[model samples]
Target: MLRFILGLVLVVGLWSAAPVAQAQNADIEATISAQLEAFKVDDFDQAFTYASPTIQGLFRTPENFGNMVRGGYPMVWRPSEVTYLELKETAGFLFQRVMITDAEGAVHLLEYQMVQMDGTWKINGVRLLANPPATA
Candidate 1:
């Protein structure tokens, strides 16, 4: 009888945990989507708000952040098309994979680092990933 009760409790616990994890994933995706939308319109000020405090500190101001993104990550600044791929969590940080096509039609893979601050998810950093070669 005790064994059955313990199993039931474990099942209940796992079931409850699943939704929390899903909610977190949804929130993280929403944050990234909102930032991308802001970028679409060149709304640097709005985009900057989605950055984590550490990133904001490093860039100092919205214009500075905007300049960096425009110069260093042109694909992100003006992506022809964007697609969300996967979200993974490691060491308490979330990483989201995104596929972006540049204006010239080159595809780029990027991983976005996200951190939660004050119960809100904010973008910490973005790293460009190498695209695999295409075989015909």
Candidate 2:
């Protein structure tokens, strides 16, 4: 029947798309992990490379960006544990959720806005989720 054929087509399309979505998520996670590793080693220049062009322009220099992270997001700057959560899209923008445990063992939930530039995922910005974390 026509309905059955259309349903089958939809299912097939989604089935093939699953792998592409998974790969994209993996790439996004890798970018975040690399930035965290760079922060661990105090390599601002390396960490800054993962940021989106807009962020780079706003910070203007790696040192400025590093200082901002060190002061404003101490948890991210020196996270003791990092866990990647769900990646969601809202209004055509993708945001990757992450749970980071700071050096003091405090848990912080953050959403990293991700943007793809020239076939690579880059971190556009990060925002801390409010209290009672993970509820976001």
Candidate 3:
């Protein structure tokens, strides 16, 4: 009965934590989506707001960040369609996988490194997935 009680408590604790995890996932997704929308309109100032401090410091200005996106990540800059995939944690970092269809209908899989700063989700970095799964 002692074992049973401890098991029950563990199960209940995990079950109750589900909603909090889901809410966090939603917030992370929203942050990415909002940045994409800002990019669509060439609003680099607004898009830069979603970036983590490290990223902001690296770029040093919204225009520099915008230029990098326009040249290095054109798909993200002008995605024809956007889909959110799994959010996974690896090496103590949270990565959000995104499937973006470029204006020409080409699909690209990208992983976004996300971090919470000032109680808000911010994008630390992004990289194209080198080996994405086969999609039908």
Tell me each candidate's RMSD, in Å, in order: 2.3, 2.3, 1.5
- Writing each residue's lDDT as its tens digit, candidate 3 over 8-100 gives 999999999999999999999999999999999999999999999999999999999999999999999999999999999999999999999
**Alpha-carbon local distance difference test for all models:** 0.91, 0.95, 0.96
| lDDT by residue for model 1 (25-114), tens | 889889988888898898999999999999999999999999999999999998888888888988977899999988998889999999
Ranking by TM-score: 2, 3, 1
**Poorly placed runs, candidate 1 (over 4 Å):** 1-12
TM-score of 2: 0.93
Q: What's the residue-level lDDT of 62 in candidate 2?
A: 99
Cα lDDT tens digits for candidate 2, 1-136:
9999999999999999999999999999999999999999999999999999999999999999999999999999999999999999999999999999999878888999999999999999999996444434
Sorted on lDDT, best first, the list reads: 3, 2, 1
Cα lDDT of candidate 1 equals 0.91
Where model 2 places Cα greater than 4 Å from the true spot, the runs are 133-136
C-alpha-based local distance difference test score of model 3: 0.96
Any idea what lDDT model 2 has? 0.95
Residue 115 miss distance in model 3 (angstroms): 0.9
Clashing pairs in 3: none
Best by TM-score: 2
